[model samples]
Target: MKQIVARGALAGLLAGVVAALVSVLIVERPMRAALVIEDARPAAPGARGGDLFSRPTQVVGGMVAAVVVAVLIGIVFAVVYRWVAERVHRQSAFARSLHLAAVGFAAIVLLPMVKYPGNPPGVGDPDTVDQRTNMYLSLIAAGLVLAVLAHWAYRALAKRNWPGPMRGVVAAGGAIVLAGVALAVWPANPDPIPPDVPAALLWQWRLASLFELAALWAALGVGFGLLVDSSARRWAAGQRAAVAPT
Candidate 1:
């Protein structure tokens, strides 16, 4: 168990580094270009850039933050894998890791994003920032809870000898229905973009943000699988050596 944890942590760190690179090279570069266009748009006499840091500083800081977030997420993936390994039937580590990653992406990214899509800087109203933040957080919390309930429902049904397809259908359908209800109850975020802002820039920035997340999750899944596979192979080799007559 200790070895597994250590390996998982190492895998997560490496994966995080890769993810950070992807964000910096692929996502941030394009996003910065889009932001420049946004900044060039005319502003009122008293207007100023609504940034805490200069563009270069923001880019470097964002890369660092991405790496840190990826590392933490990797550790979480390790812990989750450990917990699920014992409870679930034996399966290839890659398959299990991928499955977990898919569920995680759905719960953490896809669902919340559907309700509160990402926006570029200067795209939200300052007056309602607090409200928007709270609403987004609530959506994330609700999505996570629904994901857990769906998992539980699937397990419960499986234990009762329910058909596998039927169990999956019920679990998935229930979660979707619950999520729909939540979405209906939640207040929509008001559009904050002024008439002069370019819609193309906003769209590009939002798409880049989503791409960054997709890259991070993909790295986590693939990296975890490779680590687990390598570890298993080494363990098997050691076992074989121990049994061999010297």
Candidate 2:
């Protein structure tokens, strides 16, 4: 069925591409520059993890690796999105798809730039900085495109009133993202810099970068109308009523 496909394969692919792209363009580049490697050489002994920081044998290797990771992360997101979107609001397949994409773009692409401190030339290159900034803008545009189009499509699918408990999920999603952004933009020094990280400063920057990832999906709930405004309005009314007591 269409729902099955959306919940499984299609969702996975979308999440993978967005997550990987965001990781590469925004997170990966900044982390790379921060490391200050003199040469783009192969990893040596003690470079064990083969993480994002690992120097690639070929461009293809890096690309493939990124895609694989993106896909895996995307699959997880697909399930989560479907559960919440369906249970809370009964958003259609297309709407959920767009919402996932937007969330990925915002979290991966936009949030990084918002959260991180600029690393100037001595600290980092202008080209790298510019690329990261441009990438963020592109992701934001992509998210808006997804949101608008999906919203249009969503008009046709089943929709729910969204219960009181569900609104908590939406608010939580927003808070998580905001927290991640705050950490990356102003990261604390991580205890042990991962080996691929060439320097101490790079390690610190990456520490901040990793934490910001939490917000990627969280932002989606806020932007995509996953929350229940009714409760908020009611609470405000209650406050006013209490204040008007004789």
Candidate 3:
């Protein structure tokens, strides 16, 4: 287990590097454009370039943040991987990892993003920032609960010997319905987008952000899965050799 966790961290480190590169290459475009808009606005007396940090500093910080967050996430993945080892029921460790990552992405990233979409510079209403943040956080917790419910629903069906297809469909459908209802009931963002920040540009930024997150999750899943699969293979080979007559 210790070895597995170490490998998971290593995989996460690599995955972070991949995510960082994607952010630098793809996300930079829209982000820079947003910055341009931000610069044109009247700067508050104390603001530096109308922001706390320069672009270069922000870029570097973003990369480092990505790596650090990925490593932590990797550790969590290792722990969760152990917890779900038997429950996932997938033949391949890789498949199990991918499955868990998909659920995590949906439960954490995708859902919150839908509820409180990220904005680029000069986009958000500063007065409502606190409210927006609070709502976003609550939604994230709700999403996790929703994920647990969906998984539990699937488990209940499995215990009853329901077919795999039926179990998945039912669980997924229930989750979607619940999510849709919640979204409809939730308060919309109180901030009207600044007219200066074009919708097209905002969407491009959003898409880029989503793509980066998706890439991060995908890389983490694939990297950790491969590492686990490799470890299992080596363990099996060693056991076979140990048991064989010389």
Highest lDDT: give the candidate number.
Answer: 3
lDDT of each: 0.79, 0.47, 0.87
lDDT, candidate 1, 56-173, per-residue tens:
8987887788777777788878888888777667468877787778778878888778888887765777788889988888888998899889989989998999998899899999
The prediction achieving the highest TM-score against the true structure is 3
Clashes of 3: 0
Shift in Å, residue 209, candidate 1:
1.2
lDDT measured at residue 49 in model 1 versus the true structure, 0 to 100: 49
- lDDT per residue for candidate 3 within 141-187, as digits (tens), equals 88888988998999999999999999999999999899888787778
lDDT for each residue of candidate 2 in 5-86, tens digit (9 for 90 to 100): 2444443444345544555565656555744553344555775643454454443465566556544554555555655565
- Provide C-alpha RMSD values for all models, in order: 5.7, 16.3, 5.7
Q: For model 3, what is the alpha-carbon lDDT of residue 210?
A: 91
The pairs that clash in candidate 2 are: 16-70, 107-216, 115-185, 177-215
For model 1, what is the alpha-carbon lDDT of residue 21? Answer: 79
Q: Against the correct fold, how does model 2 do in TM-score?
A: 0.36
Which ranges in model 3 have alpha carbons more than 4 Å from their true place?
45-52, 231-246
